[model samples]
Target: MKLAYFYRNLNQGGIQKMIVNAANYFVEQGNDVSVVLMIPGGEYVSLLDPRIKLIYFRSLKKSRLFFSFSDILKREKFDVLFTATPSLNTFTVIGRLMARVKTKIVISERNNTVVFFKNSALTLSKLTFLSIPLLYRFADAIVAVSKGLGQSLQKVALIPANKIHVIYNPAWSPELEKQAGLPVQHEWLNDDTVPVLITVGRLVDAKNHALLIDAIALLSKKREVRLIIIGEGPLREKLQSQINSLNLQDCISLEGFKLNPVSWMSKANLFVLSSDYEGFGNVLVEALAAGLTIVSTDCDYGPAEILEDRYGFLVPIGQVNALSEQINYALDHPIDRDLLISRAREFSVNQIMQHYQSLFSTLIS
Candidate 1:
């Protein structure tokens, strides 16, 4: 099988990581795999399995990139073209048509489309929202990371229910446990006296890191707790200011992005997610793999499904008080380590890859 993944860049985001994992998995399974990028490079570009080919359209301009992408499809005509995110998915659909390729197009929706359009301020977002109904019908299959997101896509885009398949992300890789075992020499993680709470995501508006900071402040008021936010983004300075303003500089630290956040998760006492929304909370599964107790916002599409109330606790989104209170409660009563580890196995990379292979095979057959 010749499989190719299309994305803007191979950044460290959850979607990008899933693509890298899938590409690696398929290539190892003896399939020829290629990663097609519109933008030339990203941090995750180095993480690709050496066996997988890296193809770049290499243009900052959308029109040039689109034409370049179509040309590749016309020339290569891969067995399957798997694309993530709305922008790239749209391009793959229209580009395949223009190129007159017989490639089976599989588009993965990694966010709640309704929430995405509602929160987005960009004009391009509006255009993409409009294009979904017009473009996505051409794709061979549509994969939503969560059932909530699958339903949301149906409502928002008017996509046929039968066209959508709910496939969870490949979150638990063998490397996750291996990385978790690696030495992490952070003061907060090293100190057993103070409880350390960790969260991982880009410091973007949807992540609502500010709300997490406020919750940490509230959690600190009652007892000693420390928070390590482990991703970098645009809101870093603003979040730092918020930390300084609330005198939480000592308790909260924005440790930027670490390639192996599992190392930190393995040592942390608790894992917290304060996202306004998510396609699926990958970090939560990583935490579960690390045997850490979790407190996540019951945001659209992912957390509730992942945690399922039985695995971990979920609070309403953006409710600082509720988030803080739940964090405190979760700390008091942690879930069983063995149970959490057991649950994490369901999302192992090998298992998720089988579902993807099944979809691709069905399309080709």
Candidate 2:
């Protein structure tokens, strides 16, 4: 099978990581795989399997990129074209139609698009939301990362219920286990005396890291705790000010992005996710793989489904007191690490990719 995956870039993002994992896995299975990008070069570019082909366009403009994408489809005539997110998927669908190609298009929804753009003031967000129902129905298959997310997309976009499929992200791989064992140099993690809480995500508005900072400040009064926030984004300065205002500089560390956050997760005492919403929380699975205890906001779609109330603790979103209380409770009452590890295995790349392979086979046949 010749599989072509499309995305904006191979940047440090959950969706990008998942695409790279799928491409790598499919290539290893003796299928021809290619990753097509609108922008060239990203953090994950180095991580791509050498056996897989990578094609990128120089045009930053979406209109120009759409034409280039159509050219590729007309030339390559891939067996399956798999892409994700709203805007990029829209581009792929329109481009395929323009090319008049027979490529089977599969677009995966990685977030709650309705919730994602609901409060946004950007014209682009409005356009993307409008484009969802209009363009997405044209695809061969539509994948939502969680059941809750799938239902939401169907409701807002009025996509046929039969057209949408719920597929969990390939959040775990054997390579992650190897990376988890690697040594981390963080002082707080090294110190067994003080408990370390780690959260990995872009410092964006949706992540609600401000809530995490407040929760840590409250936790600090009761006990000794340190938080390391991995990943960098536009909200760094704002987050830093919040930390300073609360005098949580000592307790909270904005560690920025790391290539291998699994190593840090493996060493941390507890993992936290304070997002306002998610399509699926990939870090929760990565934390489980590291055998770390978790306390995540009971956000729509992902965390509840992943933790299932048994593997970890979930608190209502944006409640500083509730989040703090739960964090304290989770630290005091530790769940079985092996149980978490067992749950993480369900999301292993090999297992999830088999489902994808089945979908592709059915589409192309």
Candidate 3:
């Protein structure tokens, strides 16, 4: 099978990572796999599988229509075109019209299509909401990262429920765990006695990191806890203001975008996700794989389903009081690390690869 995966960028994002993983897995299984990055001249090209061919449509941009992609697809002769993200779907739709290849286009929606629109401006949000139903009809199959996300597509986007399939993101399990010892260079975190609460994700509005800061402010009054937020984004200034206003400068530390978060995950005592909503909490799965006790907002789709039955605690979304209480509870009552690690195996790379392979085979057959 000649499989071509398309995504908006090759940057360090959940959807991009999933595409890379699926493409590499298929390549290893003796399939001709290639990844087509819609965004031209983007960094992180080296992060892709060296065995799998990579192509960048330099003319493609997020705001513009993907006119050049059709030519690329025609030349590549892909049997199957698997595209992730909404913008790329537009190109896939266009490619289907222009290309001669018998391409079965599969579109993957990585975020909640409806909830995402609500965060935008009034005019733009209305336009996006209206376009989703029309855009979804273009794909042969639509993949949602969670069942809730699929339901949203059917209910809000008005796509048929049968058109969507829920596929959860795979967790990272590094071969040979990095040593648990703290680096001597991290002078602020030299004391190994303090409980470290880490949150890893892009510092954006949907992530609702401000709620985490507020919860930390409350948690700090009673316990000697340290908060480490890993990732950088446009919201840094606003978040910094909130931290300063709450006088949480000492309690919270912003570790901007570490190349290897798995290393930090290994050293952290707890992992936290304070998002308003999530398609599938990828970081939560990573935290579980790292054997960290977890506490997450009972967000729309992913967290409750993933952290169900004592694997972790799930508080109501955006409830600062409840979030603080849960954090305090988790700090006091230690979870069985072995149990957390065991549960995480369900989303291992091998298991997820098999699931994806079966799905692709079914789709193509």
The residue pairs in collision within model 3 are none
Model 1: worst 10 consecutive residues (lDDT sum): 57-66
Q: List, residue by residue over 59-104, the lDDT tens digit for candidate 1.
A: 5575586688888888787999999888888878888988888999
How does each model score on TM-score? 0.98, 0.98, 0.92
| Regions of candidate 1 where Cα sits further than 4 Å from its true position | none
Worst 10 residues of 3 by lDDT: 175-184
Candidate 2: tens digits of C-alpha lDDT, residues 212-241: 999988889899999999999999999999
Off by over 4 Å in 2: none
Model 3, 247-338: lDDT tens digits are 98887988887656756876777889999888888788777777889999988878887888789998989899999999999988868988
lDDT of the candidates, in the order given: 0.90, 0.91, 0.78
Taking all chains together, the TM-score of candidate 2 against the true structure is 0.98
lDDT of 1: 0.90
> Which residue pairs of candidate 1 clash?
none
